[model samples]
Target chain A: MAKELLKGNVAMAEAAVRAGCEAYFGYPITPQTELLEHMAARMPELGRAFVQAESEVAAINMVYGAACTGKRVMTTSSSPGVSLMMEGISYIAGTEVPMVLIDVMRGGPGLGNIAPAQGDYTQMVHGGGHGDYKTIVLAPASVQEAIDLTALAFDLADKYRAIVVVLADGSLGQMMEPAELPEMQPLKKQLPDWAITGEPGRDRRLLTSIYLQPEDEETTNIRLQRRWMEIEANEVRYQEYFLDDAEIVLVGFGTAGRVALSAIRHARAEGIKVGLFRPVSLSPFPAEALRLVARKAKAMLVVEMNAGQMLNDVRLVTQGACPVDFYGRMGGVVPLPDEILSEIMRLARFTPHDLNGHTRAAWLDRLEVVRGAK
Target chain B: MVATDIQNAKLVYERPESLADVATHYCPGCTHGTAHRLVAEVLDEMGIREHSIGVASVGCSVFSYNYFDMDFVQAAHGRAPAMATGVKRVFPDRTVFTYQGDGDLASIGMAEIMHAAARGENITVIFINNAIYGMTGGQMAPTTLPGMKTTSSPRGRDVETQGYPIRMSEILATLDGVSYVVRRSLHNPAEIRKSKKAIRYAFETQQRGLGFSMVELLSSCPTNWGMTPLDSLTFIEDKMVPAFPLGDYKVIDAVKSMKWKEG
Candidate 1:
């Protein structure tokens, strides 16, 4: 299909439809409402199911129900709404049902603002609800990436019979950009053997998350751990840019990662050897790939819209191979590219005469001239 | 010799084929076992057991799947209605139902049940209002009578503080989408027969493609009520009935004109 200008939320919604989503149930929350609205309008025309649920809790359970039928199902929400959905999400995970969830993250701890923020890194990658279960987390950095990852999420969810979450910030949800949409996929005509289709001449199927016996529960936990280990081995995805022979690496994901790319370009122009390492999957966390990058770099700078939640993951993977520094802007504040550039320069140990033999004062004068031209 | 003579004479009171042969974990004298048998018998009679899916809610009936002998899914606490809505919508040809308790349906899951009914989901709901949380050990439930004492309300439920009991049947009947809404008791043989009829009606409403249908049964929890199995039945008759009246709160014209086939 030809490239079309679309909002991030709309692109993701269209991508899900193209991926053959059979049902969508979601409650409206800011920064993510467009996705629900689009699904509400399109699903019925395609002879699919759509429900603007009473609440996020109800929406996610509806997804659980449809997923029990071995069909593609989804729900989207923001921070507080996602909190309400934790119970249902955990149930879906424990039952090993496959579904997709989109969390267009906003500022939080409470009813925070509807502005963009990456405060849900811990909640999404780590187990937010009460259990030893993990959902596949995909962080998209642009409108096109959002479309691509949303489609991939369905496949991953079904491949492992686990939930897949597309974690986008408010800016990624609200911003408009040109994207090439994927071709529509045909819906599955046959139900899987594990699905509860109420058909005769087959053994009855039961989809449940409860295990009353102590030994049974322990077995369930062990099974989940094994599945997670497999995911860690096979599903780790990350993007490396200009990392060959670089001394300083900037680590970020989602919108923060996109911003850091610009900082890396500007620093490179100023004779600084800085590169970018972006994680595409946050759950099976691209830990091994990050360790590789950490091995080559002398220093790493982690930037985020929140107060360094992903920083902890970076530190763990790096394991003091090199020093890791964090620069963050929280409470809905998005860090500017210049701020990240300055942090990268400081972490790389750049001095006055480091920028192509020009002093700091001369480099500042050149930047002012470039700004005037713009 | 008596058993042989009875077996040779006639097969009159055999268990329903839809009811599994496994033993249930229900407490002695609890009506959940009875409720399960009623539903299973209805499914057997309607000849829909092979094509019916059940959703078991959290609470005393959480393990209802073990006794249903059909495809079943367990839902999170209070989310059975939402889950049933999903199942019914995806496979409209299959009969779907939810088995929920007062705590699971009327308390924590109030929003889910209300919206499912309002949307006119083509599903049946069997709500067991036992006045107290049985599985959780005698805590107060939404259907707990104003002055009824529970472990959480040791001082005899204060109506001023805890509020009044909810009449779910009446509340759900007000929705335009609901095609059948009834309240029946399971304390006596006569009421048990009537409850069976109501449950069958609820299932028929779903099979006929009518809107949402629900039958609320006022049940007993003898172990938690601090009474004998026999006394708990009496308590349901003398005390529970007055608080939660028994009758059809909502019956559409289609349901009233319909005739039921005998099994």
Candidate 2:
């Protein structure tokens, strides 16, 4: 296949079509509108359905309905729109529907801003919807990665009988990079037997979330919890950069991880043995992967677009194995490599405090309002 | 006891293989059973039971999924119409319909139901209007008559405070995409027969690829109304019928082609 420059969002749409997704339903939101626009142009040509729904709520239900028929389906939105879809997402998860949701995240507590942010990390990984269901959250860093992971998302969604979220951000959504478009994988020979297309002289099929009995709820929750544990055990993914001989390591994801990789290269140029731990799976948090990096490094710097949201997860997995410091730039600003390198130097020289010791009341108070809205 | 049991026997009910054999969970003498029977009979008569998909909403009628033999998907309160739109759009050849209550369709799902009608989604909706939230223990519904008393309105619904009841069929008939809109009641045997015809019209319209079809059946909730089953039917005939008149509000079948427009 010939390689070409493609924005991450467009690449994702192409990959979704190639993956045999027959429907794309979404409401336009910033940084991710290109994805829906691409599908609107391409899906019709592919003999598929493309709908710009009246709202995110409607868009997700469209996905739910199409998925109920066992058709390959998807929808894309940004942060605030994704928030509006959480109720539907939870329903989809509870019902065990196979569909893909792409969140090109933006800064938010409210309509925070239409810029990149990693603020949705906890929401994505810790079951952004509700119930004990888990969505396999794939974090893509580049246009090619976005394309590849979107293809992977469908496979994972169908295989696991779960919703799969492709967690990218505005920069990755907008940035163009050279991507080698893979040949479309042939559609699966069969869909899940539970999907309800029509009766067709067979027993009627139902795709629903309601289980009226209390014991049914208990059984489903237990089954979902075990499935999540299995995913955590098997699907952890990460990229190790210069951790062979290093005293300090940087941990980040999505575009922030790419920025951190550049920062690590810069720090190495100055003989600062700072490595990078870039995660490909935002959910399942790559716990063991971070543990391995923490064991080899003296301290870790966690960089993100939100006020240290992923920091809590990192600390939970690492368990104070090494001091973890956070450098966050919220409300659409991505921290520059120069700024991150300076933070690396400060971590190397100054005795690092626990990440919690540095909370600014101004930001914390603002986050309080965001929390209430949720 | 024998006389009471005999009196409770329903003469209007038909034994349909497509419907569950169990007694309905609806309160005795409740018109929901009558409305459901009408809808079920229509599905069976059209021989579309094999191709039908029903979406159940939040109310006493939410258990509609359990009664229909067709594939059923229970949706969030008031969102069944939107969900049904998605289902119908995905499987355009299939018969998709929503069974919703006044609270679900006229109140919380107002935007969803209205937009689906406006989009002319080829799906039928069987709306059961009991004028109160039956499942939630008789709270006031959007269609509850202005002076009707409910758990939420102990002193009777205040017209000055809460305004008037919403007439959904009247509101829906104004939309150009709506192919058929009818309001029927299940209080009497004659009304029951008319309700079945209304439901049949809705299904037939969708089969013809006409736009949205709706049959709003003015139903009775004996438990919620704090009345016996027989009294509930009387209440529907006396109280509800006067407020929500029985008649076809709109019927525009686009599939009937015009010879002058065609070659």
Number of the top-ranking candidate, with DockQ as the measure = 1
Which ten-residue region of model 2 chain A has the weakest summed lDDT? Answer: A358-367
Clashes of each: 0, 0
Which residue pairs clash in candidate 2?
Answer: none
- Compared with the true structure, all predictions reach lDDT values of 0.90, 0.83
lDDT of 1 by residue, A1-374 (tens): 99999999999999999999999999999989999999999999999999889999999999999999999999999988999889988999999989999999998779889999999989888978998899999999999999999999999999899899999999999999999999999998776789999998777889999999989988998998999899889998889998997789889999999999999999999999999999999988988888988888888877888877998889889887777776776778787898788877776675221223222345345445545754
**Tens digit of lDDT per residue, candidate 2, span B78-123?**
7787778777777899999999999999998888888888888899
Q: What is the overall TM-score of model 2 with all chains considered together?
A: 0.93
Candidate 2: chain B TM-score against the reference chain B? 0.90
Candidate DockQ values, in order, are 0.83, 0.51
TM-score of chain A, cand. 1: 0.93
Stretches of candidate 2 exceeding 4 Å from the true structure: A351-374, B1-14, B253-263
lDDT tens readout by residue for model 2, A266-340: 889999888888889887778887887787678887888888888788888888888887777788888788778
Q: Name the fnat for model 1.
A: 0.83
Candidate 2 lDDT (Cα, whole model)?
A: 0.83
